[model samples]
Target: MKQISSSQLNREIIDLIQNHPEIDDFEVLAIDLSGHFYGKRYPIASLKSFASEGLAFPRSAIVVNTLGEPLEGIYYGEGDGDPDAQFSLIPGTLSVNDWGNKPRAQIMATASSGKEATFFEPRNLLKKVLQAYQTKGWHPTVAFELEFFLFSRKRDDQGLIQIVRNPKTGRPDSPTLLSNTRISDFERVIDNIIEACNQQNIETGAVSAEMGAGQFEINFNHHSDVMRAADETCLFKRTVIETAKKHGMMATFMAKPLLDQPGNGMHMHISVLDDKGENIFNAGNKPQQRLLHAIGGLLDTMPAAMSFWAPNINSYRRYSGGSSCSPVSLSWGHENRTVAFRIPLAKDGAWRVENRVPGADANPYLAMAVSLAGMLHGMNHRLDPGKPCDGSVENGDEYLPLSLSSALAISMGSEVLIDILGRDFIELYCQHRKADKVAFEQFINAREYDWYL
Candidate 1:
């Protein structure tokens, strides 16, 4: 029940222990720029000491790239000698993990030496962007629709992933589009996932089988707290993956797990509430200037924000095709899935824009940061997005970044993004992406020699 935002660590720790005695241990988690949560577990009794001093983690934590390799040219590496940074909890994130091996509480954290937050931390970057909206008295409501693939534990002869079979009829893999039969076939898996999500208090709205075989999409309920929405996304991924393993299958959030099959995506839906708690996006079917400005902002910064949306080399493949609604161009439309931004057809008071750009593999914190920043920036500058498109936009606008290298180049050089996400975080994120690009390029894939050799 207690929340610690400042120096009330001791008092808050006491209150936490008194309130949540069911939890024996605590998982101190901190999300870095690479979207990786790295930290250790401590006994609940040790919260008094650890909470005050803050659990220590290396500064290199933020510099880690997608490949898990440390990206150089950062201030913490050579000059600062990779010193330890203090990590403190985000207060109310403490929750009992129903899916864990034992009774344990988990909390989100940020690492910094001073009272100010570290810009390189993904959560901090998001917080910084959200502050802009807060300053204008514009509250943001957000939700996420995550698509993932479930594969059997066993791999093929060549170690390729195969979809989990439907036990009843013994169907290997059928692209059953929204069939209730498919839901019953995977009832146990779906039920267990629901149980796990319920334990964490994650409000899930809908669960349905997607276009691909054994692929499913889960939708979270819309909420006013943007940070909590992002937190649920990270926790939902961990919950789904762990629960899948328990059910004798593996769940992957990879953008493109298969070359021929559909890729996974994380779609974000957003709307702003005014001071009177009214949806600003509810300005008729075409929407008001505020909604349009938000669209303009997202479209304007999307090219630079591509790296954050599609963080890995394999992430780029999601846009290449095969997926039903994966967007490839930088176009916005009214309820059109072919474009990056979509104003979904909704009833009155439910109006919103869906950012269909981010892949399932993206760091939720960073992706939300860039998306929000673009909107806030657009509103500030009153950027006009022009008219909306009605077409599917196979190749309407300019081409988006096709590789991590190109995405990194544009992200690093984007003054608007740099201003929103901060120069320190932008520079740091791009460096890590650049390192990952070089590493991926150096290692030639086996398929390369299939034709050449």
Candidate 2:
């Protein structure tokens, strides 16, 4: 991970305090492997000391289950005596978080153990991949398009999810794909989200209604710095969640939040730039060799990379077929949305590949890292992506792992992935995921009672 000077962190806090004197509290947080933020809050008076001496978090906390519980066999939890992992704020991340009742400031931090990046940290994995790109004089430009759903704050009598009603018609909302009227119905919520993003220095692009009821997608502006893009994505998720609550609606990023509705996806747009700042993937409106190799690498490695994108049990439901808009095979094509890697219609200079396999629930840092690693692997070996499909392809579940257990098993056996990401990290991640699956299966759902009774 990139190091931030203590002096720079201090200056940022000072500037924030000078600008917003009403900020009575400060929150310092670190991103966990599950994409959840955990940290401590302090009064304004402690900001100065907090900048110099960082907070202490357990190293085990970095790789906990989605519920933030310590897995039984993980060595970091009790075997290591629960050692503290030092955390300091990332420079330029300190900003005013006014999405609350009272104005409070927040900062995103990174963890280090004895001045080295922790093996369990997702940010460290991404940093390692970025360094590999830097060695080859290549830079990656990336943007994330996140799809999510808004539900009523109240649930049904049976505790099932309920769609939010249309403010205009006062009726239960239904699929209103790309409907301008549907966007207008939630204008206030969208406006607040945009304003919140602006306050946090997050660059946003188009906002449109999606194919599912109360569903919408927000596109982020492309960034030359991939790390900043992932950082802003983490912040943007919090912004959308808080802003939705302000409007009496709850927002969810679950890949398949509702059983019958379309699943949410996080599509990544990525292009590689050479030292001369030329897009390597662009070749005069034709497919470039580098681009094809990159696609080939991604397709070949999708089975191993599945555990990173589809980390949860519910994530596989997104690819269960029937208008899910989720990719179920490792196909690639030009101007086709049905494939895993879509070379979207763009001019020569702006040409890039869009990876649509990741669910909105994935950790942005890890997802982007694995994608880059696969592309590099493909280019180094000059792998071919096979023939491009002209039309829609059938859902070939056999081409990819469709279960959490199967995905993790494939990930553990991938020598290419182990070479890109460290062996320790891969083993630890698979173990953690297996622990989560065990916990998930322990629960008896209502289906068991309905079917067996």
Candidate 3:
């Protein structure tokens, strides 16, 4: 779908509230560095105020690192710092926040200036990359398969810690079968999540209980525009988390929680269509092999792309050698989860490549943008990826980063990433992530390693 303008967005919001009187307040949300939702809630009557003058938020909101530290002079205060950015609501995303006790409608917002200039907002970043595909007369479709875990808040005789445990099982949980096989405990949480998604017009291809005890996966319908797909993902995660809280449970997108259990993954399936809306990846005589080169680009840049895939320190724990779903190297095979990339063997339209590198903790917009950037680089250079791996991709030498520090270094050193994402954005991102890594290191003392894991 095409991007709607400010006036169109206003009309859509007004019509929505008018039709559904149940919505009393409108919540405008922005995604933060930690993948947390941050925004303000306004009464439905004040919708006109936002539509006319646009909602104003402090410049400092986007400047801070994940730990909320200001980066000194980089603040770029108002006329100099980050200007109070404007956030106009997205048309289709208007809905009530499921977790809120009061009646409220939620809308996704983008950072914009008075002159209609868009800044380096996370969502806008992906929009620019999608526009690049449009410039080349190509349309890209993407579907994300997201996996996460459920946990009950943990408490000791002393107090509560961030570490949680599965409610059904008393001890640290595993993915195997348990005493509670009825799935009744999670029924309300799942139902609320599905209902919230429906309210936001987010489409779900399927939802299933995963291998882990509280682990679950939700597959979204493919979208022709990458921005829409990312937006839907961001909204979906928020909905799931909020709904879970209502049921007195915690939902974590953390990549890996328990050592031996399966880590949560965000597997992205991508395909490109030409001007005629036909699958470009499927038209060739040897489509699977041709797609290999695209896979090559992904594998070639994966080390550097790790910053986007595993943004947090805890994220790297997901890349274990023996995990069936974890990819150890830059390799692709038909329907093989052992490799970094998998070409699902299916019909014409269903033909797509699944990049399994990213953790569930990744930022959807950045992950998708970096991935598209890699594919574009490959398509432009006409790079050949050689051959797909046969059985396993576990070459010790070719393995991805085992920690966040190594991943950050790879991202900073990537020339291809610099060329595509632009030097300024790369530098900014690196600085932010570095600060996060340092803070995390300090927060967890040498004796606390086991506690976090």
Candidate 4:
């Protein structure tokens, strides 16, 4: 694909609306530290201005924790003087949301401030990692398999939380078995999701019902560019949540919702290719064992990387053993679900490792960034991960943190993470997450435990 310049992006925006006609507005988004969307929408008429000058948003808007607490030095420490950044819309990612009476086009944007771009911005972070591979005459491809839950809107008599269910099944909290296969009772919502993805030109591999009640997973096809993969994952979550709300259902990407059932996860499949467009993981004369060692690197860093994978307090709940889903140890085997990484037994280009540590709640940009960092470390240091774990991983020596606090502590001391993501970024991330952890723990005291969950 050819590189798009600002003038070219502006022209494309005008031409896009002219050809599509249904698109009335465009959303320019920036992924903040929390991996949440921090952006503004503009009328199509303002496309030229937005494309050229970009939108002016408070730098503080992207630096705070979810609770809005300001990180002391991250935002203002650099001097807050109108810290504006350009947002160039990715051409192919433009899509329409038709849930409203009028359709609106949505586009993902990468933020750039002066010569030094914000590396913490998820998209930019992924772009930077991809550049590292590009410089080595290699390219990275990624696929996202995301899982999430759908909950009923109704509350209990005393105003406590409860799960919605199928009336015929007589199970109030049981999963709803909608008769419409193509379009469940949630058809309109799913349709809206499909529409948004199609409008954005994101390739949707499949949408399927998961094991848990009211749970679903959407898998996206692998893209050679890491940015496109991260962009798609970000948009997927936004589309699901927005569409679910329109249909009176709550869509949650929370890692674990119910203690007993399966928890949501975001598994990433990655592979590297050479400048000649050849799969580097493939073995013709070269042995595939080298690829296994790369998987080992990911396994070695699995514990430290958990902070990025399961960023929130609720994320660790997904790590329970009985589910046969979540990974309990750092191990990899061919097509193994019990292991942290799984090497799918497939053809040359199809061979790749699926890193299962990340929960659906993770920011795809950070997840990809950390995953690339691990792979690159393995490639550079030649770290050979031992034999893959077989059967249950409960007894396995390698284990991930049991809570967000533990994960943060490990991440804070991770030399590899600091080396790759930079000390400043790591410090900023840990500070924000540490604050979140403290707030969440304080709020969830013994008296409030049952009420909050």
Evaluate model 1: give its TM-score.
0.91
Identify the runs in model 3 with alpha carbons over 4 angstroms from their true place.
Answer: 1-4, 67-82, 113-119, 156-174, 177-185, 284-290, 321-324, 444-453
Query: Model 2 residue 202 lDDT?
Result: 90
- The residue-by-residue lDDT of candidate 4 on 298-355, one tens digit each, is 9777888888998987788888633537886777877678788888876644667889
Residues 360-446, candidate 3: write the lDDT tens digits: 889898899889878877776777877767786666444577677788888888899887776766776777777667666665454
Which pairs, if any, clash in model 3?
A: 76-80, 76-81, 76-82, 77-80, 77-81, 78-81, 95-106, 175-212
**C-alpha lDDT score of every prediction, in listed order:** 0.80, 0.87, 0.73, 0.74
Scored by lDDT, the top model is 2
Q: Candidate 4: where is the Cα deviation over 4 Å?
A: 1-3, 20-24, 67-88, 113-117, 157-161, 166-188, 284-287, 321-324, 396-399, 442-453
> Can you rank all candidates by TM-score, best first?
2, 1, 4, 3
Clashes of 3: 8
Kindly list the per-residue Cα lDDT of model 1 for residues 246-359, writing each as its tens digit: 888889899999877888999999999988998877876557788789889898898899999999889988887675678877788887888889988878757888999999
TM-score per model over all chains: 0.91, 0.96, 0.88, 0.89
Q: Among all windows of ten consecutive residues in candidate 3, which has the lowest summed lDDT?
A: 176-185
Give the true-structure RMSD of model 2.
1.7
Backbone steric clashes in candidate 4, count: 2
In the range 140-190, model 2's lDDT, one tens digit per residue, is 999999999999989989898899888779897889788888889889899
